[model samples]
Target chain A: MTSYTDKIREISKRLLKEGKVDMVIGFTRGSVPMMHQPMFAKNQGDVDRFVWDGNCGINLANYVTDRKEKIGIVAKGCDARNLAVHIVENKINRDQLYIIGVPCTGMLDRHKLTASVAGEIESIMEDEAGKTVTISGNGFSETYDRAAVLQENCSLCMHRNPVIYDELIADKVPEQSENDVDRFAAVRKVEEMTPDEKWAYFDDLLSDCIRCYACRNACPLCYCPTCFVDESKPQWVGKSIDPTDIRIFHFLRAYHCAGRCTDCGACVRSCPMGINVRAMTKKLEKDCLENFGWEAGLTTEQRPPLDTYKPDDPEQFIK
Target chain B: MKNLLEHMGIDPGRLHFSWISSAESTKFVEVAKKVTEEAVALKSKEKKYMKTKPKVA
Candidate 1:
């Protein structure tokens, strides 16, 4: 990962020096352990601050929306897919970007790592071989296999290499084959439950929601000028933390991203209450894939299934 | 919309979608009857998403 960081800095510096892009977006070490913050490098001097590691879970595609200046963004597989989405949506132009693709090796889940130990994490170090992560706190220190603590989305990722890139930092890594991972196993578990059981399951899942909207803010797809939740004429969702309100908020938000979500795990990563917000979105993703033979952000040339009319489109639900 | 609602444990019959032109009264009536029958069948199930009166102040 250090070599990845070095290569990123080298490329970003050259881009900045040559005046190819007005800004370069990448990740920098966060103030705390296992939280990487997005950094915008506008000049050659700022290039040295960029770093890459397992902690860069936040999607860089969120930062490039509607930007007027040319951008050189550091994109992993999911981020690059999102960039493709942005291009298709006309939020940004393809000519305005210089995508620095980083073939991902999955991001570490901080919650999983924290749950493994009893104390607060003071520092974390990833081995040069990129196979192990060591964390130390007050009195305890432990090393964990990188694969064991990977975020759920990362483990199930089918596209680990960027779909689009101007230049890649390293040779593409192997992708997770469909046979190796049952991507819809969680969705299937929920599907088997009775209606009452399913309701109770989601009720328990969203019991801790604080209505902070961290998930909304973190998502790259949520760029609406006046989100439905904020509408006054006929407010689609209540602002209070009522269980019904929370459920509606989550449901509608998931609906909005029906055919466009890349399952980048930004919503899951940003939740302060540690909600598995992917539960709602992943169901839609599975539906899109199964019903329409569509996966979001795979290409910019074609519109999503939901956005276009097709003669063979599934209409089973419409009686 | 119906798929997601059903996925969240809502009764699939509660929502219905049909393409009926204004002149097609027979088709509209036929679809409406089916929808109402399905909704009535599940009437005994407790409503899942309806906002109720505050149980406690």
Candidate 2:
């Protein structure tokens, strides 16, 4: 609920002005202040434009891959997780990053909230303590529990605190409980299905796929500049949109994201088809938690479960 | 019954079929198309449908 813009900007500007950081990365108010987008700041002027709120959706950590030099960045809880993975993979230099940790209580479900209102957000203001939301229309204002309209994933967030950070501005956030992880019930329904029924479900889901890799692109873990699917050298999933290849692409994505994913739910949000894609990751995430006791993007020291092998490791995949 | 993929100009010889056979009447072909396209795309150029030579019976 803390809009740490002034603090972040102040720090970022100081860093930039003093040459401690080459640039600062944070959220900027979008076309309408209701929505927000990322901004790469070089100086105080650019830093002044940075803001943070629920509407800041995209995982800006994806931008840090393959970059050099010192950079200060504003990180949400999810962004912090993604950054941790990057650090573990040696894809990012942690020493170079001045992470300004921002605690997100949760985000507003804009789609549902907009419909609840008069289809327009007249104004949004910080609550007295700066820890709640107050939506106003012309002059009529309503203050409610901030947790009510959070995004599905945010509501069920397990990693709300920045796993990696140089500075934490506000109070330490709370840990996520098992109940915070959703999509288990939906996954269970599928698990109870017969083989044919499962195939039918996948068939229905994949058929709706237009071969667009929005799910891949939205994923912060999917940072490979040139992905295998895009490999013309040995074309993995072609542009043909053939059912099998499309199906494999989906599987490939799921498997690739398996232990590497932070369960940020970007893949679901960005999907044009709205195939309940989060359901898959959520299912996989639950399995990872229940079976392996591993959560992705939580730490740089802990290897992604799939990548690291131990002779003593439980072989659940054993026949 | 005419195959759902028949109108899609797919090569049956080069194709792979995944049937989501169910007890009830919910056979959706639109979903079938997605799997079909993916199988076709994922089938590498080096890997051909190995047609078995018939034994002289």
Candidate 3:
């Protein structure tokens, strides 16, 4: 893992010095414990600030959307997948990119970590092996296996290596085996409930939403200049954080990401309220995979499932 | 959603409708083949008309 970080810096320096890219977008050590911030490097001096650890969870692909600069980006499995999505959507050109692919093990779930810890985390140190994280604060410290604290999406991730890349920092890690857990069990549970029960479930699930739009801002696929929430000509959705408005916002956000979302978990991670926004997107992902046999960002040539439909697509819900 | 995209000038072939249950393997194959054929046809249609469509000044 340390070697990978060194390789990233070395490559980033070369890309910048040789004028291969105008900028390199990667993670820097965050001011807080267990948090890493996205930083841009324009020169070799700036490349020294790059960091890669369990906390580099935020999707760096979000920074590449619609940017004209010849850029170098550090991408984990999900981030790389989203980058592929950006190329296919024409938000960014493939030629403009120098992807530094990182085969990710998984990202640590901050929410779960906080829940597991009783006090504030003074500092967190991840093992060089990327297997365990030691968190210390408030006169106590504990080390836990990295897997126990993995983000929900990462735990269920099937693609842990970059689907597309200009260069890989390390050997590609093996993808999580399907026998780990039933990824869609929660969605299946929701499906088993009655209509009213399902409605009640979502209502309770999303009741805490403040409508800050952090999730939208963090998503790589949500590059629409005018999001449905901002449309005033028809006023598709209300601006206020009304329950109905929140539901509408989540619905539209999920719908917009229907076939393109790689389940990178950026939206879930960015949400201040710790809402599982994937609840909506996961169902859509399942539908896409099961019905259309489509997984986002696998190839640049293949069109998204929704964007190119078959004459006989699943229409069980349609009259 | 399909209706809205079509209303915005997206090709109708981009939207498809079919039904297949988990138990129905034959139906899934049949539907999959039909969809692929339609998609191919639609692509050629788009290419043929792309040159003929009048350009907006």
Candidate 4:
């Protein structure tokens, strides 16, 4: 398989040399092994620092919002969708972007790998074409099929190719067939419980939250100048990590991205406490798709489901 | 949720509520299919309108 790293370098260099963009946002080798950090390259010399691999999973779209300089961004499927959401939400202008779209198969779930392996993980490597991962620790090493380690959101993704792009770096990746995939199976399981049971379930799920706000900062959809949590005029949620406050914080966070979330999994990936925040967002996504036949970031022209309404809408739930 | 969305001028279609016990698998499928059809129809109508009266950007 062709190296995505090489292609990203070529495209970024060309864009910078041609003055097509003021800066290119992509990934660079992280200080730690088995990870990558988002970086910006403003000149041709800096493009060489750009890298792409299974570890380059952080959504680059988060860095593009409110950027005055023209930007060229390397976007995976979810990142592209989030950009589309940004365009529709007026967070960023589409005219200011030169999107380098990547047809992502999936991203590696680092937390899963960390939990399954023994000892401190010293080094890790992945061969995307071979669909395998090799990890070496303090005393042992092993290789496993890459599919077994895919991020949960990626495993269940319906749109694996960019729904919008300025230029695709490679041929579009085929979407996973929905025939047997139960993307909402977990959500449905939680829904089957009684109100008290459901409450306790989420309470336990978010119990480890430290109120760090990494999830919010990582999300491209979250760009409000004053987040509701930080509002002083009418503090919507407590700043402390009280369980009830945490619960409301999560609920509001998920609600804010109701129709706009692409299920990018960025929030879960960035959470220091390893909370499965997708549990909340996915429920809203299922509801939006089921009720309004809407998926966020598919088109720039169409307003989000919640932004527009028809006179005769499904009101079975409303009294 | 429906009440809040309604007050906000968002389509009530944006929210759906139904009760399906684990034993009522058939009822679940039936409700799902009906809701899917309704949403599809609403989207089609919106698309048709947008095509006829394209919004100026």
Q: Pick the DockQ winner.
A: 1
**Model 3 regions more than 4 Å off:** B1-57
- Report the error of model 1 at residue A77, Å: 0.3
DockQ, candidate 3, vs. native dimer: 0.03
Candidate 3 lDDT over residue span A1-319, tens digit each: 6787789999999999999999999999888887789999998999988988888888899898788999999999999899989888898999999999999999989888877889999888888888898888998898999888999999999999998899999998988776977888888887666544665677688888999999999898888888888889998876766565677688778889988989999899888899999988888887778878889998888889877768898666342
Of the true interface contacts, each candidate retains a share of: 0.65, 0.00, 0.02, 0.06
How much does each candidate deviate at the interface, measured as C-alpha RMSD after superposition? Answer: 1.6, 14.7, 15.0, 15.1
- Model 2 lDDT tens row, A13-130: 8889999888988988888535677789986788878876777767888788889978898887888998988898888888979898887666665555555666467777656464
| TM-score, B chain alone, candidates in order | 0.75, 0.33, 0.66, 0.63
Ranking by DockQ: 1, 4, 2, 3
Q: TM-score each candidate.
A: 0.96, 0.74, 0.83, 0.84
Model 4, span A1-319: residue lDDT tens: 2478889899999999899999999999888766789999989999888887777777888998888989999999999999998888887899999999999988888888888877877888877574899888888898889888888999999988988888888888879877848899888887667544665677689879999999999999888999998898996876766665676788788889888999999998888777998988898888888888898889999999888888866876632
Mark the 10 consecutive residues where model 1 chain A has the least summed lDDT: A235-244
Best candidate (score: TM-score) = 1
True-structure lDDT of candidate 1? 0.92
Whole-structure CA lDDT of model 3: 0.83
Model 4 TM-score on a 0 to 1 scale: 0.84
